[model samples]
Target: MIDLNKLRTFTVVADEGSITKAAARLYRTQPAISAQLKDVEEETELVLFERKNSKIYLTKEGTCLFEYARERIDEIDGVVACLRNNRQNLDGTIRLGVYFELTSSFVPEIVHAFKREHPRVRLDIIELDHDALEVGLLGNDIDLGLVTTLKKPSFFETQPFYSFQRHLVASREYLSTVSSTLTYENIFDLEVIASSNLLSDYKYWLKINQQNQLLKQVDNITKLITVKDAEALRSLIKKGAGIGFYDDFGGQSKSEDYAVVPVFPESKPITINIDVARRKTRTQNLLQDEFYDFLIEKSEAGLT
Candidate 1:
């Protein structure tokens, strides 16, 4: 008989590329993980990994075993979820991935309200980019993903949560130094600050503006400060690092006041739809369904 715990540990080690990292993720010590790996290898009589330059690489057999092991683990999890649902249990960890701005600004309130209603459910939150959030949901790393998109993907079912505008913002101190009125052309030449993410980077911002026919009007940008996430970008912008972009929801909620003024008041503000996404193929338990519906209701009521 195969040990499922060993298989689960092996899959985590394979995914993380380091036993140390896997141990940390699985909340086990390094020696325990090594023992599990050794036991699995002995049971199969296969050399599952190669050690080179103090790092472990999966062997061909390891890769094959890992694929099957991961699938089995997911199956087991689904079965457990179904059993819990049959029992009408709503006590389990619900992992969530959210964009940075929403995580800091609005997600906490929603989470608090949800937790108040369902005291037995545990919510684990992870911050990620819009695209990374989708990947996390599809890969089963997170049970739910809160993100914003111009178009929805076919693989995931998305419920529209909130609507907001992306604004070009500058610090009041920085604006006071500049004599000319803020316009797209003038703002592009200034040092631009932006979040470093697949969807929030300077190029994506430029691309979206180009699609809106506003990019051609602005001058070529040479100066930019890319930060790790929206929170960092907001901090930098507050300190007068450079002009940056912020969503209206965050702009209104954050106390720092980034001074989000309309860049080209004539052109309509960019409209962004925030959505909560879940994998269409995965089966949600009663708890997951309830949480999802709560978010949808709040969004519709303008509560979040």
Candidate 2:
């Protein structure tokens, strides 16, 4: 029989890529870690690592085993946590992942309100960009996510909570220098503040809209300003650094130094529908259900 402890030790060693480092992390001797790996490999009849220039590397099979080991460990930990807190009414941790824009403007309020109602429940909020959010959700790193859904995933289920609109905004200072409205030719010259994923979407939209031809002659590459949060992007716009896009909900919620202008030729305004997504499963917690209900009600009330 394969030992779970041995599998765990192997995973740690593979992740750290050094037995010495893994031993330090696991608080065990290097020999013990090596022995655990040897036991696991012998039991499974598979060599999981390759030694190159005295450095350890995971073989292809080792990589596959590492993924399964990680997921299994996470599942065991979650089950243990749930069981330990089962008797304590509503006294457990809930992991929440959210998009960059909503993290600063909305999530704090929601968390505070929820915590006030259920003081025993612990909330862990992880602020991630769109790509990171998706990756975390798929990897089961978070229990729930609040984000804009551009594409639907087959493995998960989602409930739409609220909708917001995207706006094309520019600083008043930049607007004063340009013609009243931006033509495609001039739009390329203006600095474009965008998140990496948002920029990809914009490029896709431009291609579909057949608006790329007008930008061919422009020398200024559309300046892509990467921001960790929506508020950060707004701050950049307030300084008159560049024109960018932002959620209308954010713009209305905070008073900033910049002026917002609607983009000319009117690209279809994107509607951001925040969805609560989770893996489909039959086993459900009463608290999880109640929290989902609360979110649905609050979202319907438009309380933000």
| Candidate closest to the true structure, highest lDDT | 1
lDDT of each: 0.76, 0.75
Once model 1 is optimally superposed onto the true structure by TM-score, how far is the C-alpha of residue 65 displaced, in angstroms? 63
My TM-score estimates for the predictions, one after another, are 0.60, 0.61
Error of 1 at 25 (Å): 57
Task: Choose the strongest candidate by TM-score.
Answer: 2
For model 1, residues 1-304, the per-residue Cα lDDT tens digits are 6698898999999999999999999999999999999999999999999989868999999999999889989999999999766545468888888886677668879889888777788999998876777778888998888888524488888888888777666677777777567655466677777665232434455565654455543334568677766677778877777777766774573454735444444544456778888888987577678788888898888874
Kindly give the stretch of ten consecutive residues in candidate 2 with the minimal lDDT sum.
214-223
Q: Tens-digit lDDT track for model 2 on 1-304?
A: 8888888898899889999899999999988998889998999999899998868999999999999989999899899889656634577878788886778767877888788777898888998877788778777787788878635477677888878776666767777877766676567677777765346545544655577774344334645676767777877876777877667774572364336565553676566678887767535877776677767777877854
Count clashing residue pairs in model 1: 0
